[model samples]
Target: MVQLDLIELADLVRPEQLVAEILRQNPQMPVPVPLEDLARLAGISKIEAFTSEGFEGALIANATKSQGAIFYSNRGPRPRQRFTIGHELGHFLLPWHRQAKFQCTAEDITSGGNKDWEIQANQFAAELLIPAPLVKTRLQKLKDPELAHIMALRDEFETSMEMTARRVVELSEYACAVIFSKDNVVRYPVWSPYFTHRLCVKKGERLPAKSPSREAASDPDEWHELDAHWWLVERRGEDTPESVYEQTLVQENGHKVTLLTYDPE
Candidate 1:
């Protein structure tokens, strides 16, 4: 792995800028970026498992944030641990994430909500590990956006479904959204910038019974169509698309992912 010079990258403030600079410098950086090495070069002294209660990950750094060590839980798959390291590294690299210690829960690792710092850190981590340009290039090659395509890319990127799904939603030209659930309860929703309507399903709400994600069927991978109103809460002046395309991939331990798409028109 080619080492990055933090000094050369110090001027970048936003997560996108910092990630772009990193890729630019290491133009040959391989797919599924060598995150651990990148973290070390960025001054993370160590990345080790921490089994402490209530925290999935933590970062402890010196007063000026020159150096630090990341302790992430061993609870989930390796992909999640890698993401945690990337997330904490975001805390270390971004000048404004100045806390001497950071303790992150699974929710923090998963969704940052309106907390700008948490949001930024998660942004940094996703971009660092998955690299948006790579994702876009791959999307361009796919004939259509679907759960199957994202699933293949997820394995190729060696990332969790949440990371891969959100990245696709962020960059896909198709108007679309991704919902992540555990045991059929909506954990969060991520929609592309082009998707304008609000999904009726809020976080923690049970997915509508008619939704493909809630159905037990012979082919979970098949795309199903439903009235857009089933999933969307329409605004006062608009008509929700007559039908939206839905596909689901049930994951390990009842974790489920569903993708919704429609014509950009």
Candidate 2:
């Protein structure tokens, strides 16, 4: 069993470093080896597809610290499968994650779980697919921040819109955030601390009416900004008043991105 301080390991292992370590362990491994191969390198051998009672996937037992089981339902899109596998792998590798099994759902991968581990796993997955340094260089080269640019990065990194949006929000300087909605209701929103305190969209609540997201036939490609009060609830007794700007991206596939901004007052 390899000994590692989980927190220290988390901090020490950059995505590239982890990938390189996998390659070193599996010398004959193919470049861009399938995610399964990486899992095996981490001591997970059994990859089974079955119907999960309530979880999308799980990793059961790691006594040897070199072998475990990975299970996922044979459902959903390929990206979702990849995400589930990645999520389980995260549990297996994180030293602090000690459980007989880890049960994860679709929302669990994106929205559920404690904030720190969820964020850590998310950061791990993001770094594994799209290294921050490379994305930073790309953002530097392309000064214009547009939805089209995000699509380009998605292609370049071979990741989903959600992954690309999170990284973009991190790299972008213009007080931006990404709000995901389903059936016209907000599911989760990720924002920078600068813009967090002022954001008004409530979880599980319907989107604002005046926003382009409410339009019957809205173009997901364009961005439109509106006043802060349109989305945020007002403070009843606060002395200082604040406002936010919103940009909407209604994906043709049904997902939405609401980019919120605030003028540095």
Stretch of 10 with least lDDT, candidate 1: 212-221
User: In angstroms, how far off is 209's CA in candidate 2?
Assistant: 2.9
**Model 2 CA lDDT for position 151:** 74
Best prediction by lDDT: 1
Per-residue CA lDDT of model 1 for 85-184, tens digit only, reads 8899998898888798998888888887567888899999999889988888899999578888888888888898788988898898878999989888
Lowest summed lDDT across 10 adjacent residues in model 2 is found at: 1-10
Model 1, 35: alpha-carbon shift in Å? 0.5
Structural similarity to truth (TM-score) of each candidate: 0.87, 0.69
Q: State the displacement of the C-alpha of residue 69, model 1, in Å, after optimal TM-score superposition.
A: 2.0
| Residue range 1-265, candidate 2, lDDT tens digits | 2222233344344444554444344444332226776677567888888786687887797564456898877876665666677777777776556565777776677755665555555555655555555676777787645667777887766677777778887777555567878767898877654454445677888888777776656555665666667765567664222555555666656667766656654
lDDT values for all models: 0.86, 0.65
lDDT of 2: 0.65
Model 2 TM-score, 2 decimals: 0.69
